[model samples]
Target: MRSSFKSSFGSQSTHRPHKMGYFSSRILPSEPSHFTKLYFDIAPGQLPIVYRDEYNVHFLGLEKLHPFDAAKWGHIFQYLKEAGVIDETAVVKPNEASDEDLSVVHTRQYLDSLKWSWNVAAIAEIPPLAVVPNFLVQSSYLRPMRFQTGGSVLAGKLAVEWGWAVNLGGGFHHCSAGRGQGFCPYADITLLVRCLLAHSPAVKRAMIVDLDAHQGNGHELDLGSCRNVYILDVYNSGIFPQDFKAKAGISRNVELRHYTQDDEYLNAVEENLEAALQEFHPDILVYNAGTDILEGDSLGLLSVSAEGIIRRDELVFTKARDHRVPIVMLTSGGYQKRTARIIADSILNLFNKGLISRTNRNVR
Candidate 1:
């Protein structure tokens, strides 16, 4: 079944069958969307990292209601600042993605669906947005998402140039091109990979390493087993968005049982990732490094400890670097207050271990 499904996924991209019914299964348009200033080169002093103050969603007391901290990005940046890893001037500030930039992946119909606050509320998993005025919701929630989406796209380009890049916000893997769901309002993952493939002749193949607690159905459906994309998703089996159909697209899918801890988790990751490297070589690696796998994350269900999460990230980056593959990492989930601290710590570990460095082609 897996082989046959894989063949179907490859064929659909070339054939473009009508009425596939899935939300994000539609192939994108041939032309690039606007090709705006997103391609601007970073200075030699700048880090291959992207973030902005607006990336945090804090319009009112509403953020307090949700378990996920919409303000997590800012907290992570602040911690990095105090730690001397990064500062305001050193980190790249991404431009907000304009509507045309989003159109590359989203259809007009799916984009229009966001007009109703009810739809947006469901997408963001924040019920209060349903009653908020659409205009206010747009500014408060959607605008922040657009900025993160832009960061993801820019990070993709930076990864192709530098060996690694990180977007402190993004990893909307649950939102595909035509639909938004699971706390993800935009198909940022799909857009990033598509943009890289379209613009860079050197970038032929890409790998999506989704370590998020929830299934990354959006990009799975969006790429639909496309020939060049190799998806390796390791998530809790007892979680949300159990899209059996989408599972067909994962080149290497590892679903863990509930409450699974460090030993079993690390073993699975190393064996599977090693096997993936042997089977396929991707030009770029997109790491959805969601910290929700932390032991206390209720939504994640699994019991991976703080040290485990840091080890997990280091393993991925080290292996990818050894194989000479560039990487783009996105902080997809795990917005608990502690998640920020954990992410910052893991990043620090990466730097200390000499796994990640701030260098430019200028230095080269």
Candidate 2:
């Protein structure tokens, strides 16, 4: 008997059948766990951007098979540097999230289950990874996810302090406390929310503006019922993880049809977001900015153009900033080769619009 929506696909999944069987019947952790200093002080010249080299996945060329650009973070970083906007000395380097940190949101049973290579392979959507040894999978695959998870947590704090922050990676919005799916291994978005709620007294209320091509069922499963979090999701009506159960939890929802173009997409975003802001004023906004909506993306079949995507980002940032709400942006679910370049362009647009700025923090 499948208990959740994810496990319901057990009979349907021909590729990897282990997804459902892996879900053990166990109680989730109830209390919050202590974590290390995922956040740090930034000196002059440092941008509130979070990234690290380990965020890239390069193992035996197996990552090439996936539609995703595993090293897209590196590409975005290089482009920014080439543009003379940022250098290695400026970006924030995040520490790998330890077991203690993850346990704050994930169950002990779920964490233990990831020790198997097959499990990690399933979450990563790479069939070749199932052959890799468990230890190697831990280091090569899961380690980078941990780093990105920590980056998301750190970005939450940076956004509150600096008024805005961006994690070059993360936005694992499809993984919840007890489950992982849609190439998302960790519940980083949930972790960031918990961190902010616990750390910042000013951030009493938060909003998740999920504009990904697909539904953010992971964070929806985790934070849906919480009164403190308001979710305004705009995703393709026809797509993966068609989680109607999760959709019921959204405070505001805009379901776009397949191949929806820029005008329709942008208009929906602006109107819905404006309405959400009017209904509930948040102390902070967490934007799941996925570039998968680019026209050529196989998985994200939406036809939003590169230029439209850039304008979309600018619109979101402008709204959040104008509302005096601290915001954190995460680069999620962009699969095509051009996704990284478009992302870089959008960040540049944000800077040009004065929505985000260089903090110029001194070297620590």
Candidate 3:
């Protein structure tokens, strides 16, 4: 049966759909802004999944020096196509985020800082980028990130209107409004949350479910004081970015030990996530699904198998579906060469389990 959950507005871009009548509407923006281009409506036939070919970062083989698989986003999409889950036309392509759009969250000084190649290199943690020309750096690296940032913003609206959305290339959790680090240059998660709260009338309160291996200090720093936002972060305590100050922002914190296995890891997730849902009712859920915790990953320093990764994704999606909260998922941080395949498999598992669908059924 065709699901009754259709977008609140069609291709013309109107107010959020009638299905969101359950939540009281907030005040709409008095004047339209340039950021509206990022929230333009998608066709009903297109899935909420957002991706673009330009999302892959490639630059004179410099990207190979970094541990990150720069082309992972493209590879995931290819696998999904091979699995017959989606084709090129079925996916939603997002526009690149403009300076004005990014100003919604970033400081003007920080935005100006990126024009220097040295600054870009430092933020991306790639020393080679320091020697590269600024224009080349912009084209080969920063442009793709801008597109991914735009995807995150668009996916936020898509999730609210259609119940679920996935951006194939975002989750820059280490970058705050003023600083970028850990290979994350832009705070896409923060931008998404800010844009939604300002524009999506039905989404007054938002929840961030950050299951990444590293601490999500960036968003915590950005939204920590926000009473309307709830954060639940489950990460390896022994890993990088141990920001005690950022811990102040987390409503529910699960700090796992080094080399924690699947049973213990999954248990903590289930317990804390369930408790968090009971404590707060969110209109939208931002899920940072990072796969770096796989057993052999040297950086994440944990021991979750590929099967465990799949199960973990299922658990989160099931909880979101049961709660009827709109979800937008981001592929955060995972460095292994095989990480792409694991992500593809986990997403496929979600589809087979009926946790996500093109029609976005079973949502209020």
Clashes of 2: 7
Residue 91 lDDT in candidate 3: 89
Best by lDDT: 3
Alpha carbon lDDT of residue 13, candidate 3?
A: 10
**Runs in model 1 lying further than 4 Å from the true structure:** 3-33, 361-364
| lDDT digits (tens) for residues 1-364 of candidate 1 | 2322222112111112112342244334334745745566887688988999999896477877789998999989999999999998889999898888899889999999999999998888889878988998899989999999999999989888888999999999899888899889999999898888888776887889999988899998888557677788888877899998787778777777788788888877777677687777888899999988888788998899999999999999988887888899999999578999999999999899988787643110
lDDT of 3 by residue, 1-364 (tens): 1112212211111111112332233332322244457888898689998999999998799999888899999999999999999889998999999888888778999999999999999988789899999999999999999999999999999999888899998999999989988988899998898888878778888899999999999998888667677888888878889998777767677777788789888887887788788878999999999998889888899899999999999999999988999999999999898989999899899889888887756265
Backbone clashes, each candidate = 0, 7, 1
How does each model score on lDDT?
A: 0.83, 0.83, 0.85
Name the lDDT value of residue 180 in candidate 1. Answer: 91
Residue 222, candidate 3: Cα error in Å is 0.3
| Candidate 3 or 2, higher lDDT | 3
Clashing pairs in 3: 8-17
